[model samples]
Target: MSFWRAVLAIIFPPLSVLGKGCGSFFIVFLLWICGWVPGVIAALVILNNPER
Candidate 1:
């Protein structure tokens, strides 16, 4: 992942730019940075939830 993308994941804990090209790894990292609940929520939204 890109440096800024990783930084973004750390700060936002699941909120990265859409199609930022970071992928699931970024989501997992974000979860690790934050916690389980936030991580799972982020992953679900990123992986399954549609754009609104």
Candidate 2:
């Protein structure tokens, strides 16, 4: 991920991974709705995991 993306992930988790595809966006969005911290954590994990 780029510097701006990292920044976006921190500020708004769901918007940051939009380019990653619909599934990722949906998962992150759900996590975000559940809780702020979990969503950020999920976004970071998903962003880091290339295999996903």
Candidate 3:
């Protein structure tokens, strides 16, 4: 659900901070600027990925 996704975006930024093919640091930075939800989602997605 979006609620949980948003929550994940807050807890872990590096995973959910989706950007224009940017690196982790950039993604994290963007996520921080955007808000907590984006960060958590980025972090979660990154963590969820098996290939990392």
All candidates: TM-score: 0.38, 0.88, 0.51
Better of 1 and 3 by TM-score: 3
- Judging by lDDT, tell me the better candidate of 2 and 3: 2
**Model 1, residue 48: C-alpha shift (Å):** 1.6
Please identify which of the two predictions, 1 or 2, would achieve the higher lDDT against the true structure: 2
Q: Which stretches of candidate 2 lie over 4 Å from their true place?
A: none
Residues 1-52, candidate 2: write the lDDT tens digits: 7888888888999999898899999999999999988889989888888785
All candidates in order of lDDT, best leading: 2, 3, 1
lDDT by residue (1-52, candidate 1, tens digit) is 4566555644654554445356665766666577856764564455444442
Candidates ranked, most accurate by TM-score first: 2, 3, 1
Using lDDT as the measure, the top candidate is 2
Candidate 3 has its poorest 10 consecutive residues by lDDT at 12-21
lDDT of each: 0.56, 0.90, 0.59
Global Cα lDDT for candidate 2: 0.90
For candidate 2, the TM-score is 0.88
- Work out how many backbone clashes candidate 3 has: 11
Each model's total of backbone clashes? 0, 0, 11
lDDT of 1 at 1: 43
